[model samples]
Each structure stands twice: as C-alpha cells, then as structure tokens.
Target: MSSSFEFTSENQDRFSQILSRYPYKRAAMLPTLHLAHQQNGYISPEVEQYVAGLLEVSLVDVREILTFYTLFFQRPMGRHHIRLCKSISCWIRKADRIEEYLVERLGVASGEITKNGNFSWEAVPDCLGACELAPMMQLDKDYHGPLTPDKVDQILEVVSDSDSKV
Candidate 1:
C-alpha cells in the first residue's frame, strides 16, 4: 500500500540514531513507531506498513504492538488529547465526577472530540503512576491533578483560549 506519510529528513536522522542503539532492527520497533507517531500524529495503516518495512518485520507485528499500547493512538486525535486516569487510586478520588464534568463542559462523550476540534478525551484504565495526584488527567504532555470541577473548568478555559489564538 502507498503511504502518504514519510519522515522528514530530520526525523529520518533520528530514526537512524535510534536504530544504532539496538542490536537488531526489530529491537528498535517501539521507538521507531513513536517517531512515526510523533511525525504523523497517529498510527495509520500506512504507518504500520512503513515501519514494518523499515524494521523488516511483518505488518501483523506492528499492528499487535499498536493494539497493546494505549499510548499509540490508532486514529486521528484533536490537537489536545486528554487521558484521565481511571485506576483504583484515581477512582477512589472521584475521577468519575471529573469525567462527567468534562463530558458536560466539552459537550462530547469520552473518546469523542469536541465539534471545534480542539480536544478529545478518554478515560484510561491504568495508573498514570501519579498516585499522589489521584484524580489526575493528562492534557497533551502535562499532567494536572487532584482535579475538581472548578480546576477542570480553568484548564479548559486556558486550552480553549490558546487554541483560539492558534
């Protein structure tokens, strides 16, 4: 299959550097896929094929890796993706209420993007490793936590404003 995606020359250089750290090309699969995801924003079918060819692995191998990792987004996401930790620590802290607030405030369900395309959110099943920050959620790269409805509102305001400026 023809892929619309190709790494920029800089990323190709980074990919080569990553490969050098592994004894076998297949050992570099995760980082290579991360680079592709960073470049393409999600793991497309074409990206799976491209990486498989690059790593000399089968397409099924790549697909399996993608499925196993929640961090690898398989479809397009809004510019800001929110991952709310729903692990035991978070759940006890009333993360469900935070999730409800997000759905209501954003006017979209979990796993769905808002109509303006600025945000998408999902409740993840695993610990985000921040038990101290229970009821936490990740917005793009940053983690915000001990969340209350008011805190969530402030975050959305900041993000929405920045998105509008963009």
Candidate 2:
C-alpha cells in the first residue's frame, strides 16, 4: 500500500472483528463507513476506495453507504456543524421559524457553507433524540436547545472562538 493509503494492521484487524460481528460483511456496512468517517474528519473518495478494497467490495458499495448516511459528509465541512432540527415536536415550537431567523440573522441558509469556513448550516428534518428541547440545533457536536436567534448568536460566538484553538 502507498504510504498515504495504508490501512494499518491494527485497523484492518479491528475492521475484520467488526465484520465478524455480522453474519454477512455487507451487513457491516454502516460500522465500516462510520470507521472511515471517524478516522478522517469527513468521508473522502480515498477512504471509500480503501474500505472497498479491504472488504473486497466494489467502490460503488462503499460510496452508497457514505451517501446514504446524513451524518457522513460527502464533501469536506467546516469545523462546526449547525444542525437545526425541523422534526414534528420542534416544528410545533418554531423550529422552522428559528431556521428562518438564523438564515436572516446569521446570513447563511441550510446546507450552505459560510464565507469564513467556520460554520455549515443544515436543516435536520427529524428528531435529534431531544424533542423536549425543541427548536434546537447542534453546534460542534454540542446540543443547544429551545433556541432563539439570540441563543444561536451566542453559539456562533462560542464555536468561532473555539475554532481558533483547533
């Protein structure tokens, strides 16, 4: 394997163990994809190709898994992810309105990257396991809920400040 492309013996072993968990290797697709994404900040074609080769599967097989998962970033993303939930409970509490407020207030719409590369906004149309914390969004993997435009501004400040350290 090329220097940049090598999957270490340990990683390969772990992957093998993960595959063994399932009766079929194909059933282990999500775990395999999650491993690829965890190693890298986001899913890249190179990772997909490597995993495909390791599993003796086609590249399309790998690509399909990456594309199917919303958490998997098909392209590189900013340091922080702003996922505004639009699920039913959140919607009743103004999740969509908060989304609108953020777009108007923060000047970035869902699925768009900011000019500063510090943020990426997306509208998540499902429960984030915290319907009680409706009108919420996750920033930098941290959940902030029952939101208002002001709270989003606070989160943006915090995320931007933290990004400089990384």
Candidate 3:
C-alpha cells in the first residue's frame, strides 16, 4: 500500500472541531490520531508525517505518541481485532487454553493477522475490566467471556458473515 495519506473532508471538519476544543494544537494529538486511524486502518510512517504537519509538531513527536499507546497500530491489521485479556484474573480462569484454541482455530499466532486478513488476535497484559467474565475477550467493540471452543466458533462464524456483508 502507498504511504501517502490525506484526511477526508469529513475528517478534516472533525479535526478542526477537535482542535477548537484544545488550547494548543498539540493537545489535540490523540483525537487527531484517532481520526487518522479511522480513515486508514493503522498509522503508517506517512500518516505520522501527515499528522505532524497538520499539528505543526515534529515527526518524532507523532512517533512517540503512536509508540507509547497500545491503541495505535503501526502496521495494517485485519478487519477484526481480537484482544484477549491475559490479566491475573483471566489467567486464573485459564485464558491460556482460550488463547490456544483461538490460535489453532484461526491458524494465526498472537499479533498476526489471518491469511485472508479477516482477523487478528493479541493477548493483552492489562485487565479488560471484566473480571466477572474472566477469560474474556474484546472482539472489536463487543465483550464476550468464559468462552468455550464452541462459543468461539459461533462468534467467529457470526463475525465472518458480517464481514462478508460489508
């Protein structure tokens, strides 16, 4: 993919609105990055440059923010980003088995995308704040928990079907 990036007109408008909320343009960095990520699935080096130019910050400044936050992606990711919590609570509930099942079923290791680019999985170090649903995963925006292989299969099937429609 090309490294060039330009914010869409709608995003430009949103960007301006976001900047208006901040006393300094630099203060708008996070939300501006969000808009870039929404427009381009991940933040590439070119996106960083584009963002720095817009905010009048150095490229290194943009890179620092992107690297410091787990929310940002430096490379392309699949349509579905699966974040499985591996916190103490999740571990006590056997999140490992869930991770293994997901790896085996998806045929992709953690931090890697599926061959077809439909999904990507990652094991998160922090609590997903769903201790009650220990052994939980955040698929895109939805939270599912206490998963079994069967439930996983069902979820994947549903996600696949929905992805196809889009």
Candidate 4:
C-alpha cells in the first residue's frame, strides 16, 4: 500500500549528474528511467508521470519508451527477477523442460510473481548472450548456466538462504 516514490538524496545527485550529460532533457529518458527503476524497483504510472514532468515530455512519450524496451519493469517484480532463456541455443539444450521445472517448483506460471514475494520469472525468447552457457538463466544480475533441475535447485536454495539471512 506504500505509494510515495522519489529518488533518495544520493540518487537526486546522480539524477542531476545524469541530466548534465544530455544536451536536452528528453534525451535523458532512458538513463532517467533506469535511475528511477534502480531507486523505486519498478516503473509505475506515477513514475511515468513524474518522469514526464521532469523531462518536460508527454506521459504518452514516456510510456511509449517504457513499453518498447523489454528491460523496463512496469510492476513490482519481487526481490529476484529470473530471466530464463528460451532462445534457439537454450531451447535446443532442453530449456523447455527447465521452464517446466521452474513452473512446477515455483508453483507459478512464467511472468507471475511467487506467492512469497521473493521471486518473479519470465521466459525470454531472445538470446541472453551466453550461448556457451546454454540452458542458462539470469537470476537478478548474475547468469547461471548449463542448468539441470539440480543446479536450479541449488541456485534457488542459495538465493533463498541468503534472503533469510538478510
């Protein structure tokens, strides 16, 4: 139910720095959205409005950029975001079965958040740029590869355990 979103003081400084790099305010859209996402976790409608106001652009303009980019998250995506590669290389490596395992193990369909609010996942149809690590997934910011159900279990276990410690 929490609603307020703004850059922290440090991020406000960073935002100022970001603005300085662009010749025009509108040119700063991507980096500004990235800053907002880093600080707020996701880009909500309020954020679109806020950014639009900041850059002196229309809300439609901000939204168009947001929707066009796959990396920008439009909703809360839990503490961990898992991107499973379903590209040709990964699919050939039995990534389909791995996706099935994730659905079964997480008790949620792809693109759904886990009930516990700790994880959300999506199957990416495009390459994750680690073809050598076929059957790979990007968990948060790290890529784990050559996955089997066992490796997936271990990865989830490690992340879950770390979450508990924090």
Candidate 5:
C-alpha cells in the first residue's frame, strides 16, 4: 500500500474541529473517514493508515469500520453512485424491473461503472427507510421512487447533461 497520504491543510483543520467534538480521538473515526473520502473519493489502504495515525487508533480498527459501512467505497466511484434498494419493501414493489432498466440503459452491470465514468450502480440489501416510496433508488444523496423506465431515462438525461457542463 502507498504510504504517501496526507490530509490537506483545510482538511487537517476540519479534522481537528471534528476531533474536538468527541471526548476521544477514536470516536471521531467516522467523520475523519468522510473527510478522507471527500479528498480522495475512496478509502484506500493509504487512507486507512492516514486515518489510523490521525485518530491514534489501530489500522485494523479503522479497516473494520471502513469495511462495515456500505457508504464507504473502497474503490473509486463514478460521478454518480446509484444505489437501488433491494430490501423486502422494494422487492415486492418490483424493484427488479428498475434494476434491469438501469442495467440496459447504462450498458453496465450492477456494481460496475459506465464506459464514460458517468454512473455506477448497485443493488443494496439494506432498507433505504423510504418504504412508502417503494422501488426507490438513491442517486448520490437524493431519492427517487416508484420508478418507471421513463423516469429513469429522465433522471439519466438530467445527470448526463449536468455532468457535461462541469
């Protein structure tokens, strides 16, 4: 693993502020990991070492937390990370169709990035806590639900256009 990780000055200050909120440095692990992810887009082995050093915790402790959280990506993600809920609520609502449509439309299998690096998708086993809006998928931080192929196309078009501008 690479050992050249170093948080930026601003992130270091942010880390200090986050650490101050907790009684122990180890308690600040989650937010510290978030800062690292924001900097590097994914938690690599180097990031685990960097975070372990910052929190004065064992690398194993940091790795355990990283592996346990679905939100933390060990590998790089595309501009959009799409998570389709595969829990009971969503499954009964025919979330499978939504997944299939996305796979066909994006030309990538689940948990794979698109050719243009615009999108990555996965079916998550956890409930997204929006059962009322079943068959829901989260694109980045926002939830869209009761999804139809038409809606999926619209969402992809908007995201694609937005990405082009950037």
Candidate 6:
C-alpha cells in the first residue's frame, strides 16, 4: 500500500491561517481538529497526543473535541465511508439484505474499514430523510438509495477507479 499518507504542505499553511483567526490558540481548536482529520484519514490516539501538545491543551480537551463531533472519526476508516440506513421505513423495504450484501462483498465488519482500505461501511438507523429512496445509504457527502446490491456494487466501481485516492 502507498505511504502517501500525510497532510500536504499547503494544508500546513491553511492551518496557520486558521489558527490566526482566534485570540487564543485554544479558540482555533475546532479547525485544528479538522486539519488533523484531513491529514490522517481517521484520528488516531497518536494524533490526539500530537495535536494536544501542538495546541498546548490537555489530552482530555482534545479527546472531548473528538467525542463531541459526529464527523470526526476516532477509529481507522477506509477511504470511502458508506452509511446505510436501517430506519423503520427503510428496513421494511429490505435494508437488511442490502447490508448483508455490502458486508459479504467487502469482507468487513460493521463500523470498521475494509482491508483494502477501499471502503468503510457504517450501518446506521435512519431518519434517512428520503422515504422516497427508502433503501438508501449516504456515501461520503452524497445520498444514494432505492438500492439493490447491484447498484451498490456499481458505485463501488467509482470508488475503485484508478484516479481515486484516499
């Protein structure tokens, strides 16, 4: 696997700019946390320590930042995140089968990333907000639903596309 795993030099400049936005460095905590996640795919314990030191905060403070945000991930995750909705409405439409398909195909457990790092799937209950697209999953920032495993497989094609990167 490639070791091209680090925040770019430009991101460092952006971090500096972000930190400058506040009176105290602690005030920049939010964006700094984001920068750390952007650099590493997921927030590791090592990152927690490093950023706490960099920001001169207690590890508890940094841990709080991670726990409070739904977006920041503490565990390792694949390049792409797939969140399947298992709400009452969606489940009635056979969302269970869809989850099984994804799990079997990717060979990964719930709430964990795949071995290839091509995908990480999270099966969550929804108020999916798209009853019209009942059997749905939110892929990254996009919503995909009214699904069959075939369609999900097709989407994986794009995730594995040569041009894609983690």
Task: Give the winner by TM-score.
Answer: 5
What is the TM-score of each predicted model, taking all chains together? 0.91, 0.76, 0.92, 0.91, 0.93, 0.80
lDDT of 1 by residue, 52-71 (tens): 98999999999889989888
| Backbone clashes, each candidate | 0, 0, 0, 0, 0, 0
Ten-residue region with minimum lDDT total, candidate 5: 1-10
lDDT of 3 at 7: 95
> What local lDDT does model 2 show for residue 128?
88
Ranking by TM-score: 5, 3, 4, 1, 6, 2
Task: Put down candidate 4 lDDT per residue, 34-64, tens digits, no spaces.
Answer: 9998887899988887888889999899989
Could you tell me the TM-score of candidate 2? Answer: 0.76
> Which ranges of candidate 5 are over 4 A from the true structure?
none
| Model 2 spans > 4 angstroms off | 1-32
Two-way TM-score contest, 3 vs 6, winner: 3
Q: Which pairs of residues clash in candidate 4, taking residues 3 or more apart in a chain or in different chains?
A: none
Pitting candidate 1 against candidate 3, the one with the higher TM-score is 3
Say which prediction, candidate 2 or candidate 3, comes out ahead on lDDT.
3
lDDT of each: 0.92, 0.78, 0.92, 0.92, 0.91, 0.82
Model 2 residue-pair collision total: 0
Candidate 6 clash pair list: none
TM-score of 3: 0.92
CA error at residue 45 for candidate 3, angstroms: 0.6
Give lDDT: candidate 1, residue 83.
96
**How would you encode candidate 6's per-residue C-alpha lDDT over 1-166 as one tens digit per residue?**
2223344789878878997888888888888888888788778878777677767898899988888876788887887888899998889999999999998989987898887787898888756688788899888778887999999988888768744654
Which wins on TM-score, candidate 5 or candidate 6? 5
Superposed by TM-score, candidate 4 places the C-alpha of residue 101 at a distance from the truth, in angstroms, of 1.0
Candidate 6 regions exceeding 4 Å error are 1-8, 126-132, 162-166
lDDT of 5 by residue, 1-166 (tens): 4478889999989988998899999999999999999899889889999899888899999989988988999998887999999999999999999989999999999889998888999999999999988999999889998888899999889988898898
